[model samples]
Target: MKKREVLLLAFAEHPEQREKCWISLSECNFSCKGCAALSKKERSRLISSKDLAYLVFKSSRYFWGKIIKIAVITGDEITLNPESLLSLISNLKDYSVKYFELSTNSFMIDEDLLKELIKLKLPILVKMDLKAYDEKIYKEYSGKSEVRVDESLNLFEGIDRRAKLIIKNWKIRYLTINPILTSK
Candidate 1:
């Protein structure tokens, strides 16, 4: 199979820990109002998943004098490229990364993607950002309807139930963040 590639932004050590790092990705499915990533003038370059894994590993070693223990993959929307994301995770595991935290908008997740993630056999924490529950609020904030997010949530729930039966220890966890919105 051909290896997938993703748009990489940067790799940096976690604020408090040398053994932890953050892998930032560029581009997003949604153009949320006031998003900092959207405001940036610079564009991220596309990189193969294997190359990205190597760069992240090297960065951790260079900065921390050790391998990365935890890698948090965050982006405006990391789930935009499911294949590349899975490849990145698999590559990171090859580097012996112990844990992963993936932050996403939860608008792109589907059954196949979730299954691929579970097959990686790595402990992954999924941070699902729900812009807003109400359709109007969601549209106002993200300039997109909440229908996709709803579908993602439903799909995840169904897959997660089946996954629990297959895996002895299901390591994936979901965190929902609903930002408090103020009317203009």
Candidate 2:
């Protein structure tokens, strides 16, 4: 399926993390002042989910069976286009990816989306950055007063029996708490 939202596709080498395939989606929901992605002067083009999946599978072969340790789905916030993420991931069912690490702000995911992710039946690593535990700090950084950190955590817990693999085996990993620092 062709999607007009997905922007760029690239590969990187992380010694500690091994080879990785990075997909950058455009349009973020956050208004963080110091966001590096938003500050960049680059623009990416739209591509189909089939193309993205093909590239991911080919990227693994490029490593000569080294195993693409991680297939990272990141952008301003991938959850903004959950359909695209799910489409791309569903197409990746034939590959031998060790893990699919979704780096998100954890502000957009809810019960329905989590349930769809569980349907994928692939090992998932949610690298969520809890911007702040304090409401004042969160509002200052993310520019949103909703402060959904706790609510998002509860949503993850709401995943049904199908997602036992994620919760019971400890596949879900929360990232460090690093709020977007600004001079505001």
TM-score for all predictions? 0.75, 0.73
Best by lDDT: 1
Residues 112-181, model 2: lDDT tens digits: 8888988888888787766677888888888875557567777776443232232222222112212232
The collision pairs in model 1 are none
lDDT of each: 0.69, 0.66
Question: Candidate 1 lDDT, tens digit per residue, 1-184?
Answer: 3333233434344344435656667667787888886214343445667987887777667665777888888867788778888888888889989998888988888888988888887888887788886999999999888998888778666443322221233223222212222111
- Give the Cα error of residue 132 in candidate 2, in Å: 2.4
Clashes of 1: 0
lDDT of model 1, residue 177? 17
lDDT of 2: 0.66
Question: What residue pairs clash in candidate 2, if any at all?
Answer: none
Candidate 1 residue 79 C-alpha distance from true site, Å = 1.2
